[model samples]
Structures are given as C-alpha cells and as structure tokens.
Target: MPTSSSSPPTDSPTTGGHRFHALRVVIPALIILVWLAGAGIGGPYFGKVSEVSSNDSTAFLPTSAEATTVQNRLPDFLGEDAIPAIVLITSQQKLDSADLADIRTLAQDLAGLPEVAGAVSPPIPSEDGLAVQIFVPLDADSEVDAAVEALRAELAATLPGGLTSYVTGPAGFAGDLVEAFGGIDGLLLLVAVIAVFLILVVVYRSPLLPIIVLVTSTFALCVALLTVWWLAKAGIVLLSGQTQGILFILVIGAATDYALLYVSRYRETLRDHDTRWAATKAAWRGSIAAITASGGTVIAGLLCLLLSDLQSNRSLGPIASIGIVFAMASALTLLPSLLMAFGRSAFWPRRPQPIGDDVDPQVAHLPARGVWARLPRYVARHARPIWIVVTLALLAGTLGLTQLEAKGVPQSDLVLGSSEARDGQAALGQHFPGGSGSPAYVIADEGELQDVTDALLGTEGVASVAVTAADSPSGTAPVTADGVQPIGPPGTPAPDPTVDDGDVLLQATLAYPADSAAAEDVIRQLRSDLGDRAAIGGPTATDLDSNNASIRDRTLIIPIVLLVILVILMLLLRAVVAPVLLIGTVVLSFAATLGISALVFDHVFDLPGADPAVPLFGFVFLVALGIDYNIFLMTRVREEALHHGAREGMNRGLAITGGVITSAGLVLAATFAALAVIPIMFLLQLAFIVAFGVLIDTLLVRSVLVPALGHELGRHLWWPSRRIAAASDPAPAAVRADTADR
Candidate 1:
C-alpha cells in the first residue's frame, strides 16, 4: 500500500517541457472558449422549445394506428380541424324557456371568441331539465390552454347566477395536460438543477469543484437542446412536453455522472503528476473508457425504443440518445479542459497533495479508506454469502410485480393535482351521456354511410349517431334507420353528407365516458364488427391503441435492450460471464423496482393506475443506468486486475470507485426526484422507480452484489483474458492486513 509523503517533489522542467507548457495552456483555453460559444448559442433555446413542440397525443400516435388515420383524414370530411370543448351548465331548479334562451345566447357569445373555430352548437337540454350541454370548437393550432382559460373566465362572468359551469372534453383534457407540463421548461429545470447542485456540493465539499462539474453538465444540456430544438423545428423528429422535460433531466444527470467519474480520476491522478496538463491527460486516459462505455450503453438502450410501435417511444429514442452523446462528449472534452485550466485550486480548501515527482503516475495511486474500504473487506471475507443474500433480497422485491397494474390510467388521472377537466367529467356523467362532446368518429366510404350508421346505432354502448353535413345549419345531421334527419322544421329536406374523395365521417355518441374502460371495450367491439368497413377513432380508441402499442413495445424492446446492453458490456470489459451476471443482476433490480413501485403507487400514493408505457420506460432507464454503475466499477476493476490480480483488483476497485459512483447515483436520483414536482402522473411514477432503482443499484447492487460476486468468481470473471490464471491472486498479506490500505 502506497501512503502519502509530506515532502514534495522538485520541479526540474526541461527547456522543451517549458516551451510546450504555454502550448498546453493555450489548447485548454481554446477548448474552453469554443464550448463557451456553443453554450451561449444554445442557452436561449430553453424557452423556444414550445414553438416546435406539442402536447397533442394524436400527433404522436403510431402512423399505423386507426386513431392516427382518423385524425389525419378528419379535416377532409369535416372541412376544418379543431379540438372540441364541452360546456355543461347545471342549475338546482328546473330551467324554463327563459333559461333555455339565455343558454342559447351564451352559446352564441362563445362562438364569437377568436379561439373558437367553426360554430358553437345550440344548447341541448338533458332529460332532467336541470342541465344543458353545448359544444364549442377551438382552433387546434392555437394556444389551447389560453383559449380554455379565456372560456372559463367568460363562463365565470356571463353564465346565469343559478347555473354552475364546467368545460370537459378532449380539448379540456388537452388544456389540463398543457397546464401540467407548463412547468417543464422553467420550474422542472430549476428544481433538477438545484437538486443536482446540492448533491454535488455535499459530495465534493468544495464550492469551486461542484460549480465546475455543474457547468460541464449545464453546457452539455444547452448544446443538446440547441441541436434537438433545430431538429424538431426542421420536422426531422417530433417533440412532446414529456419528452422535453425528460431531456432536461437526462442531459443534466448523465453529463453530471460522467463529469463525476472524470473528476474522481483527475483528483486521483493529480496526486502523481505535478504538471496540470499531465494530470489531465492521465486522468482522461484513466476514465474515458468507463465514461464512454457507460454513455454508449445508455444510448444503445434508449435507441432500442426505435423498435416501438408508438411514435412517442420512437421519438424518445433519438432525442434521448442525442442527449447522451452530448453528455459523453462534454465530459470527455469540456470537463478535462476545465479541470486542467483550474489546476489544483479547483479543489479549494482541501486540495489534493501531490506525490513525489519521481514516482510513475501510471502505477502510483492513492489508497482508499472509510466505509468504502471496510465494505470491500467484508465482501472479500464472505463473498458467497454477501452475493446470495443480496440476490435473494432483490428477488423478493420482484415478487411485488404481481401487484403492478400497467394496463393504462384514465385520462382524468394523467394530471396529478387539481383538475377542472376531471371535475367536469364527473359533472357531465351525472346528467347527460358520459361521452358527450368526444364522440367516436368513423371514417368509411360514402356509399357505406347508411350501413355504418346502422352498425354504430346497433352497438351496445353507443347512444346515437350523426353524419357530418356540409350544408347543415349546425354542420351535422342526426342519423336514424330512415336516413339523415333534417336539422330544421319537419318540411325541410335532409342536408347532404360531406364527401371527401370517396369517404364520409360518422360520429357515434357513446353511453360511457370516452376515457372509460367500457368505452374502450365499445371501440374494440366496433372495430371487430365493422372490420374493413369503417375505422373507429377518438379519445377511447387513441388510449386503447397507445396502451396496446406500449405493451407490444415493452415485450419486444425490453429483451432487445438487455441483449444490446449485454453486448456493450462484453465489448467494454472483454468478458462474457461478468456481463451476463451484471445483466441478470440489473434485470432483477428492475423487477424489484417495479414490484415496490406497484405497492407504493397503490398503497401509499393511491394512484389510480399507470400508463402501460411506464414499465417500458422504467426498464429502459433502470437497466441502462443500473448497468452504468457496474460499468464504472468493473472497468476500474479490470484495469486494476491487469496488475493486482482479480480478487485484489475487485476489492481495490470497489473501495476507490464506490464513493464517487455513489455520489453520481445520488445526483442522478435527486435530479429524477425533482420530476415529482411536475404534476404529471407518468413523470411522478417514473421519478420514483428510476430514483429508487438508482439508489438500489448504487448503494447495494453495485456496492455489495457485484463486488462480492466478482470476488467469488475471481479470475473466471475476466474470461478469455490472456493472463487468466495469474488474475486470481489476492493482495499481498501486508496490504490485506492493513484493512485501510489500497
């Protein structure tokens, strides 16, 4: 074990060394300036993402989905595109004709709003005579949240005193989603940044070092955003509010994790090399493989989402992969340069003391102490038991997966906090048909309009049917067995249905809420009965397809992701057995996370359910990131094993890398935990699963399970290594006895 010496080494610089010193300083300065310029260019893109991004679910559905097809062809048959808002007004007393006139006047007023597109329908009284419902269509391209706000404000001021008003429909839900995601750009970023900063501050205990690491992370995020923003603007890819929020957190967490590894290497390397440039180069050499491999593993896992049938999942593949690329690049390039430029002063009050100059920087390294040192000793003593206990514990947690209900949550539950739309949904269901305003749309051949109408009317949950009529006073005509009914007096002729190419649109009013399971069942039944005759779409169908697509994606992509990561690990460590064990461990960890999350979500938080995509996203992040920690550990272990032998190397690697990796995991967990601040159920659940899994991987799995398992396997862990047999030896007796020694 190498102990620190008080005497410092003399600086005997050669003429050439002195000459190149200026060049070395100049190179780092240049790198810093270039990164600064990029950061400056990308900083403002944070606010501009909303310009090219959307919260519209339909726009991000798989192109092959029936809902997507219906959405695309809707403007053709309807003559315009719009989001529908349902206005429900209820009074304690039965309404008279005067009340009906006032409701009609209010509908007219709503039609005059700039955000309202086409026409507002006349109020239809419920059978109870105490409530009325009206449809107000809004321009889909405009700021819908603002439009909804304005409409609510209008209702507050204009509606008669006896009536209570609510806006509830697809448009209302969209507005709620927008409001929930409104915090992504500013508040979410602020919370994540603050959480990361606090963790870094605690981990480094040096004000300046944490700042440098944070700057590297922030710059990476800025550049990633700058690139992704332009890509989205060019329409090369799609962006959503959820994706945008995830990008912010992913870039920051990944970049910071990479930076932490580099910082650890740089701090340790500084002990041997007196020159800042030499220390920077040596540290880069020490950490680059692990950093790059870890980043690549995550990128590969994220890219597996490209196989997803859901467009949202597919888009996340490229978007998050871009984030990871920048994370690696910035850590490798910017962080080293920053550390080199700052020199030892970056550590501030507790600067690392350099070893004597004559020592070889490659072989000379610092010893490990504290719990990190002691824990490795424990693993070395009881290797088999340690791994067995941890594995059983993890497997036990996996048993909770049976409680996971990942079928898909109700639309009303998507936003986590208070919601007017959710309340309005309840109100609407209490009076008129539960699926008011958001009707299932059927697009079929104009020739089959009658047949489609009859089939829809015959459907179990369907309450009524209507066909779009270009000449109708209200833009739609009721359809009965006789035919399309006149919109006006009995003597008037029926309005002709709108025809686009050879297709016509039929709207089916459902007896159940559009987002209800019963409604989804209705859509499924309709699709079955009307096979090839008509395409069924709308809120219920969209949810059904999105959920089904998510299920398919997870089933297909999870296994592929595991294989991709396994191959990456094999290449990274040049070992097949270790990679397999690591993958199995991480997969076990993910299952445990899901199991525990299920318990917490249902028993603790009382969440209704989860989007089917939750498990898939959770698997992608936990497995990729769980493997990331192991990569850092094993890469260091392999490096040490080359000289010290496998048993000794595993112990030394765990002691040295454990603290930094734990710090990195904590930073990542904190950043993800910040997502809970945003009032969306998906982000909240994702935050918990990933954050908790990271901590589990960090403090337990990577710390004890992997090291103990590696200790048990010894040289066999590094299969195919040329010096396989020699790799099993333990550290010299003197070092092993010291307990605190490296």
Candidate 2:
C-alpha cells in the first residue's frame, strides 16, 4: 500500500533506444547548424588584409641582431615580405623618340600605383648601339596582377601605332590568373563531374547510387567552400586561385567516399533486418570503427602541412582539415539519418539480396558471424607462421624506404604556360645574351659596401654586376630628324652607366639556371666564401632557403604526428600493449607505401626522385590512414572480448568488422586516386601515395597482418584489463559457436 502502488511499468524501451531516438533528431539539427555556420560565416573571414605592416618606419626596419641571425637560418626571414615583382619589357620596334615618350609615360603612370615598389626601364640608347632596360617599383601591399592590368589598360588607351608595350612579372602572373579563371574553373568542373561519376558507378554498380552520392556530395562541398570563403574573410586563412581550383574536386571526392562507405553498409544491413531503425543501428555499429580510423588518418595528414615552410602550405592544412572533418561528421550524422529516412528504398529498383542468401545463421545467435568469421580461426590455426612471414616481408620492404630521397625541380616545372611568366623566362634567355630567369641581389651592408660589391663581382659564377642605388639610368630620349629618330634594339650594345658614389644595390646575374643544380651549388659556394663582406640576396638564394626551411618543418612534424596518433590510440584502447602493436603495424604500412611509391615514381611516373615534399605528405597520410585500420580492428576486438573471450572475440571482431573497414579503405583509396589524373605532378604523387597506402592498409595490414597478430596475442593483446583477462575461457567457444552458425 506504499507509494510503489502507483509505480509505472518497470520495463520501457531500453535507455539506449530512447537516447538514439533523441539524438536522431537533436544531433543532426546541431550538425546542420555547425555546417551552415562553417560554410556561410567562415567563407569570407580569411584574407581580409593583404599584408600586415605598420606606418612606423622603424617597425619596418631591421633592428635586431636576431633579425640577421634568423634570416640566415632559413631560405628567408619571417616578416620580410620583400618579394619583388619583375616586369619583363619587350618592344616590337626600336625606341624612336615617339615610342620612348610613350614608354616613359606608361612607366610614370605605373609608378603611381600603390603597390609599385619600383620599376626601371633601361635608358634610351645614348648612341645608335646602346641597349634599353626599364624597371619600376610597386606598392608593397598590392598584388602584381592588379598593377599589370591597370598598366595594360593604360597602354591600350594611350600608346600610338609606333610601338607596342606589355608588362610581365609577378604582377603579370597575377593578372593572367584573373583572366584565366573562367577557363580553369570550367576544366576543373568537367574533370570533377566525370571523376565523381566514374568512381561512384564503379563502387555502387548502380546509376542511382552515383546520382545520390553526387547530390549529397555537392551539397556538403558547397557548404565546405562557403566556409572556406568565410574563413578567408576573417583573416583565418588565405584563399588563392590554386585553393579554389582544387576545393570542389577535393571535397566531392572525399565526402563521396565517406558517404559511400557508410551508406553501402547501411544498405547491406537494411536488406538483412528489413527495419530502418535496426539497420541504422547495425550499420553505425559496424562502420563507426572504420569511419573514426580513416577520418583520424586524413586529419593527421592534413595537419602535417602546418609544419610547412611555405605560408601557402601551412594555411592549406587547417583549411583542408576543416573540410575533412565536416565531411566526416556529415557521413556519421547526416548520412545515417538519410539512410534511415530512405528505408529499404535506397537499394530499390536494384533489389536487395535476400536475407537468407547473405546471412550466416551459424553465428547469428553467437553475436558475431559473417566471410570474416572464418579469418581469425584460420589465422589462429597458423598464427605463428603467418606472423613470421608478414613481419619478415614488411621488414624487408622497410629497407627500400631508406633509398627514398626528397629532391625535385623548381615549381616552374609545375606552373602552366603560354603563361607570360613562362614566355618571359624563355624570351629573357634569348634576348639577354645569357638567361635571366630572375636576378638575385647580393647586398652586403657592413658599412664598406663598395668592397662587398667588388668581392661579389669577383666571384666565378657572377655574370654581370650593376649598382642600381647609385646613378639611376639616364640618357637622352632618342631623336628623329625633325622631332625624333627611332632607337636601337631593346638590348643592343649600350653605354655603361657609372657606379653610384656611396650606397649601392649589387645586382649579380649568376651564370647558371635559377633552378639548376649548378645555381644551387654556386649559391652555397657564395655563402661559404663571402664570410665577412656581405650577405647574399636573390631568388636563387631564396629558393635554397625555402628548401631548407621545409626540411626543418618535416623533421619536426612527422615524428610529432606519429606520437600524437600513438597517444590517441593508447588512450582509446586503455592499454599500452595495444597501442604499441598498432603503431608498429602502421609504421610497416607506411614503409610499404613509401617503398611502392619510390618504385612507381622512379619507374612508372618517371621523374627525378619524388616531389621534395612527398615524404612529409606521404608520412602524414600513411600514418593517419594506417592508424584508422588499427582503430577499427581494435575497437571491434575490444567489443568482442567484452562478451566472448580473447580468441573467439578476435575472430568475431574480424567477422563483424573486417568487411566494413575494408570497404571504407577501398572508397577512400578510390577518392585519392582521383587526384592522380590531375595534370599537376605534385597532386599526382600525392594521389598515388594515398591511394596505394590505403590499399595496403586495407588488404595486407588489416586483412592479414592484424588478424595474425591478434590471433597470436590471444588474451594478452588486452593485457592489464581485468575484464578482458577474466573472460578468456569462452573466446574459442564463441569462435566455434559463431563458426557453427555459419
């Protein structure tokens, strides 16, 4: 007769079912809000300012002894945004007095632009033989492209029929990018559609599947791009044309992959249970391990870019990481909900396989059974030998990784041309007696600057020397019989100007190609020989500086990422032994990936070594993805052990989860392979490395190596876990019972 008389029924739905029902609505709504905020609010947050500099002169001045010290440490110093733009000057005819007037007028107009640091045009011929050169300075903050466009517009408006004028340099390159955007975007879009269509069709074997994937992918990608654009506006990241060109394809490719993995599983489970809620739960349970693992891998790889020497590379990591994470969440939340909503119809008109045909009854009551059910039992039967063979093979492949070198040609090898920059490079070589890819300035200012100039001029690799700070080029404009006569050729034999009296800018033209081995060697020698005279400055030196800086970044980042993943896995497993084995296997997968990549690049792709950054990139991807497989397999193994014992648990874990992880790996690998078809060499290498790594991680490491190790370890795999240790007796019984059901 107490208060218990009015108690409600003891049994309602399980707490888990209620929680799942609530999350099915709430979590998705929250995810949608996050998605919108990231896409809509984050898009314009980056690139709000072109450069950050103060009006204070000393703020721009180099005052600290640490300034020079830091400058010497890498390719260039931080806070030194002194990348000078070149305007390659060309003439259709000799400089007549009329043409000279037009050129000077245009130069003066260009000089007025905010970003024109300086421009110099060689003096008009003093004699009939004197050569002509022009140079102009531009605003420090404004990009070269805008200045070039303004000047081009001016030239079109004012230049008379007597001559033609054009500007090509960094500004010119920027100008060209703006002009070429339409064409590039069209090409990229075409490529993305074709690639996405092909990949989805191959994986799903249904036209509807591909269409569904594309629509969902496009929605997610638009959101990611919008987010990136907003982030750029916020000053959080920089969005360049290169970033834009790659974003759509990358997002589509990555998100479709995650969706494909999750949705495919949901379809299989739906066919089995014929209940949307049960299928959703089963697919989520089956795929959570794989999704978490692979997503972690991608995130780790992208984060590795943060250690890059190039500001562009560093910025890209966080930006790409955001998209990857968003895609992952969409796969986990949005995708699962969509699968629930679609019910059995998603696989329709293509009839789902009958439950009896696909289901293995022997293992159904045992809580784990499926093709994967047989794997652990087989591995345990021959665990010792299988482990020995895999370990030996992986160790043997590890040797090839040592031969992998990081070296490559300059980026000019990658940039497109008929591009004015490319044309200018070629024309400069033809017109200027010797090649002038870009001139490097070696200015030494220990006060006795004249001696430093002489020292540099005396160096063996030095081609020609000029001191521009003194005696700015001055000559009488050409004269005609009445008002003007035509001038000589653009770079004809010209009168030499005398050096300035005091401070001088030593412009040293090197005798080797800017990107050549010889040029790098000369740069190194100059640094060694120029002890106290002055410091070397120029594009070649800058190239070398950036290369070394990148190496430093790689050295720091790779180990740090590996360590981070190791710690993450250890925490997840709550066991030191599990993390250690997992890391070891991942390392082996990476080695195999690198060894195979070296073979492909050396023999298949055929370039000098791989890209300079490939090792860093490959390390990032391989370790990240490799750990993903480990996570999936281990999580299931732990789940199985909790209910069944160690041996049966290992078998059941593989049976239940193996197909899911393998499918995820295949889809992710396929997406990365899409990058290979890109014409760019760096992207191609990245594609091959990632695609191949995922394949190895899935087939060899996850399928064979992990199972072999798990079988060999038995209960010891989860050592120090009293729960696991206590439940060891029934593992073989569970394995046998699960197998009998099949």
Best by TM-score: 1
Each candidate structure's TM-score, on Cα atoms with residue i matched to residue i, is 0.96, 0.73
Each model's lDDT comes to 0.88, 0.59
Q: lDDT of model 2 at residue 338?
A: 60
| Model 1: worst 10 consecutive residues (lDDT sum) | 1-10
For residues 1-742, what per-residue lDDT tens digits would candidate 2 score against the true structure? 0112233312122347777767766664675566556555534432222232111111111223222332343222111243244444456455567666656666666567655554445433322322233444445456545666666666577655644344544344445544444333455556666766776676567766666666556557666766676677676776555445445555665677677667856765655564566667888887776676667767777777776655555666787777777677777776776656555566556745325533464354222445566566777666678878988887777777766767655534443334664455444444452324245555454354446555655667766554432223322122112321223567544332222322233456677656556777777877777765556655566556656655766788788887888777777787877788888888887887787677777776675555556777677766776677677778767877787677776777777667656766765676667555445556677778878888888888888888778767777777767677444544444545645654
lDDT, candidate 1, equals 0.88
Question: After superposition on all CA atoms, how large is the RMSD of candidate 2?
Answer: 8.6
Displacement of the residue 477 alpha carbon in candidate 2, Å: 18
In model 2, the runs with Cα more than 4 Å from the true position are: 1-120, 123-197, 205-216, 239-254, 264-310, 350-403, 416-427, 430-437, 474-504, 531-533, 725-742
